[model samples]
Target: MYSDDELRPVSALQHFMFCPRRAALIYLEGLWSENRFTAEGRLLHRRVHDARRGEKRPGVRVARGLEIRSYRHGLVGKADVVEFHSSSPGQSPQVTIVEYKRGRPKPALDEPFHVQLCAQALCLEEMLGRGVSDGAIFFGRANRRVEVPLDTALREKTLAAIAALHELIGAGRTPAARYQARCRRCSLLHLCLPKALRPRATAARYLALATQPPAPDDA
Candidate 1:
């Protein structure tokens, strides 16, 4: 049974998207190692996440590390930053989930970050009982916010991803590796060594056949 804590971190989507084996190793088998990139990312998030106070800038208000949960999707996580805007002080505010990324947009979908933002929007919608309008992905390098609409298609895709994530995590086995261009950028290359291990499996099969006794021939 998954505890509430297990169900609750946005980081799980990151693992589920990155590699099922990696997710299982960390979440289930209790393995964790921090690389320099991860360390720096953590340092950047620390100050942003630690900010409990809200800052006002004209019509917008920025709140950091806000707790978020989505009963509809059975997901929970914290938003890096949520911006709120209102017509007046007493009026209900419009919420936007702005995810802070340490890197620029990649050719491939940053599934982890995308999924995280979707989860945040889901949570906000549930809490507000009103549909969320839009969200944004803020890249530190670019120093800009790319607005993302919470449209029907994106919502459906996010839900599907969550379902897939749940299935992958529940399964105890890791997926077999296949090389792709993305493998070069993978942080787990040293740990995975997919290419190195492939030939070894083939060699083991050949060696086993060589040692096997011949079967009796039928006349």
Candidate 2:
């Protein structure tokens, strides 16, 4: 278990991992400016989170907006949906966390979503005293659910990411922009102008005349 002073929210780890500046701005400075993407996600979550009044069907119960907290990791979260599995009405409950995302499944990275879901699992496991072996990510764009296993590998990665996040926050450093194509759509593009800062923009004319191959050596 971790002390409250030593723990950071799981969502912060994802933001810090993706872009430190953005994380710092949001967490430390309390700055937020939502665009179309963020607005859409909020609307989607509102629908599910608002429907959390517990509905029962056979041996399963669907719960929404389940409050969750992990003291060991220093995170507070809410599951958009939780499916409680029971063999009988009197049996102990097993929890399965489901998170809602506004985009389709990611291409090469699951770290961000996994960390968030893992944190919820940790909270549920602590509160319920049962192992959480798996969870799901529901993508809004694709209307699909992705099952993620809580294997040793994912657990280790999630913990490691938490540790790294603490170190980064402690150091108070923001990484320089790498200026990839992804920057174009970033909400912070106006704040992070890689194109304007590029050396090519300042030296384009000088290089053009110098690289004319020296007029065939003027023999």
Candidate 3:
């Protein structure tokens, strides 16, 4: 169990899954640089996150910007939305987490997103003292939801991520950058400079070697 001060944001798991260096860059170094992708995502979620309201539709209740946390996992964050589906008048409502994304569904590249959703589900389960069986990721581009199961495997993975996140934040040391295909889409690409600061050399060495011309006699 973790105290309020020790709890970390659930979003860190997604960043950590994407790249440890990127997580460190944001959470450790306090650096950020927004690009088109992040700006669009921010805009897409602005309406949902800014409002804390709920609506009812027959057997379901939709909550927007619901705050959640899990002391057991030391995780804290808000779900974009959570739906409570009542089966009967007195039966417990099924909790379902719905996270908003900026783009269309790309299952191949949605592992991090899934993990983040799973974390939220775990938080809800702990907070509400009920089992959270499933959740969904709503893609704004397609205006559709991709369902995700909060099975044991995903739960285990999310717990692992939470533990690792606490370890990362506790150490107070940022991981080094390593270039990857996804880095191109990261908003902090400019600040991280994964290519320039990758292992085996420093940014100065990379820049000096890349910029300096070959010697006249070495041709």
Candidate 4:
């Protein structure tokens, strides 16, 4: 188990899954840049997080900006919303975590979102001492919600991601960038300079070359 000081943000899982080098850049190297995509996402999260009050419905209770954490996995973060649905009068309510996103759903590119939701569910379970069978991601552009099962496979994947995140942060090394189609959407594209640097060289190696002394000429 990791100490409180050792815990990393749950959001890092999404970053790590999206691109390890990107994750290292943001979390390890403290690098960040804003683009339309990131700005929109931040706006959506800000709106959700600003609503700090909980509302009660007939059979459900909705809480916004719920802070959650998992000591077992050394993860900590906030959920956009967590709705508790009551089945009976006195029994514990079934938990459903809701995450708000700014764009439409893209199944091909949404694994990171699912992993993020799963991490939220894991943290919720630990916090509430209850089982979180499923969660949902609400897409603003799509105006729809996609349900995600917190099954063993997804839980295992989330745990593995948390482990990888911790390892990456502990290593304190930014991964070498390998340019890809998705790099265009990355906010750190300019900072990463994936295209300028050779894929085989580490960021440290590239920087070293930039500052190295001129080579001696052969006589």
Candidate 5:
């Protein structure tokens, strides 16, 4: 179990999964830059979280901007929305965490989002002492929600990601950048400078040259 001081933001898991160097730059080096995508995402979240305090309707209760944390995963963040549905009186409610996104879902790049939802479910489970088997992601662009199952695979991946995030933060050293297709979309592209730093030669050869001690000058 991690202490409160040791916990990192749950959102960092998505960043880390999308790009390790991007995570390090933002979480470790405290760097951030706003782009169109990020701005839209931020606005969407703000709108979701701005909903009035929790409300109950018939069989369901809706909460907005609910703060959550998990000692097991060493993560903390606020949920955009969480809905609880109670089937009958005097029974535990089923929890459904809803995350809002700005763009349409992209299956190829949805792993990070899945990991994020799973992490949030884990936090809810720990806090409520109940199983949270499902969640949803509401895409603003599509105006639809995609249901996600909190299965063993997703849980395992979420745990592994948390561990990796802790390790990366503890290392206290930024990783060297490697250019990739996704770098174009990264808001930290200017700060990361992957293209400028990426090796023209083989990666191993570049590392050797970079780490090798300079030759002593002869008189």
Candidate 6:
């Protein structure tokens, strides 16, 4: 188990899952930049994190910008929202997390979303000593929340991501930039320079270079 000081931000898991090198660029190197997508996302979270904003309704209570941590997983961060729902007067309230996103959900990148929410649920379970069975992601574009179950598979993925994140941080070295289609949307694209950092050689060039004889030895 990690101490309080050793805990990493839960949000970094999304970065690592999206791109290891990108995560390194941000956390390991302390690099950051603002793009349209990032700006929008920041604003969305800002609205959700309003300190004075909260809600109480019949059999339910809502907290915004609730700080959460999991020493077991070495993760810590502020949740967008957490709802406590009680079915009966004498029953314990069910804990559920709700995360907000600026963009609509994409099928291709769904696992990372699940992993992030699961991490939050894991933190709540440890902090509250109550089971957090599920959560939801509020998509700004769609204007809806897509509920997610904290199933075994998702928990496994979340744990895996947490482990990999710790491993990356422990290594203390930024990974090489890798150009990909998704890099276009990343806020760190300019700083990351994945395209420029990529090797300027093709498979044929590598084959030709490999077949070349060694130059004459200079004593």
- TM for every model, in the order presented, reads 0.79, 0.79, 0.89, 0.89, 0.89, 0.88
Choose 5 or 6, whichever is better by TM-score. 5
Q: Report the number of clashing residue pairs per model.
A: 0, 0, 0, 0, 0, 0
lDDT of 5 by residue, 50-122 (tens): 8677887888899999999999889999888999998677888888999888999898888999999899989
Error of 1 at 11 (Å): 2.4
lDDT of all predictions: 0.71, 0.73, 0.84, 0.86, 0.87, 0.85
**Tens-digit lDDT string for candidate 1 (116-186):** 67777887888788877779888776677788777777778777777877776677666765656665555
lDDT of 5 at 17: 98
- Model 3 misplaced stretches (Cα beyond 4 Å): 50-52, 199-219
Q: Which pairs of residues collide in candidate 3?
A: none
lDDT of 4 by residue, 53-117 (tens): 78888988899999998888898999999998988777888889999989999999999999999
When superposed on Cα atoms, how far off is each prediction in RMSD?
A: 9.9, 9.7, 6.2, 7.3, 8.3, 9.2
Quantify how close model 1 is to the true structure by its C-alpha RMSD in Å: 9.9
lDDT of 6 by residue, 91-177 (tens): 788888999999998878877777888999999999989898979999998898899989998899889899999999999999887
Deviation from native of the Cα of residue 144 in model 5, angstroms? 0.8
- Rank all candidate structures by their lDDT, best first, as comma-separated numbers: 5, 4, 6, 3, 2, 1
Candidate 6 weakest lDDT stretch, 10 residues? 210-219
- Model 2's number of clashes is 0
Task: Summing lDDT over every window of 10 consecutive residues in candidate 1, give the lowest-scoring window.
Answer: 210-219
The pairs that clash in candidate 4 are none
Per-residue CA lDDT of model 2 for 92-174, tens digit only, reads 77768899989999857656888778877887888777898879999999999999888888888877877777776667765
Best by lDDT: 5
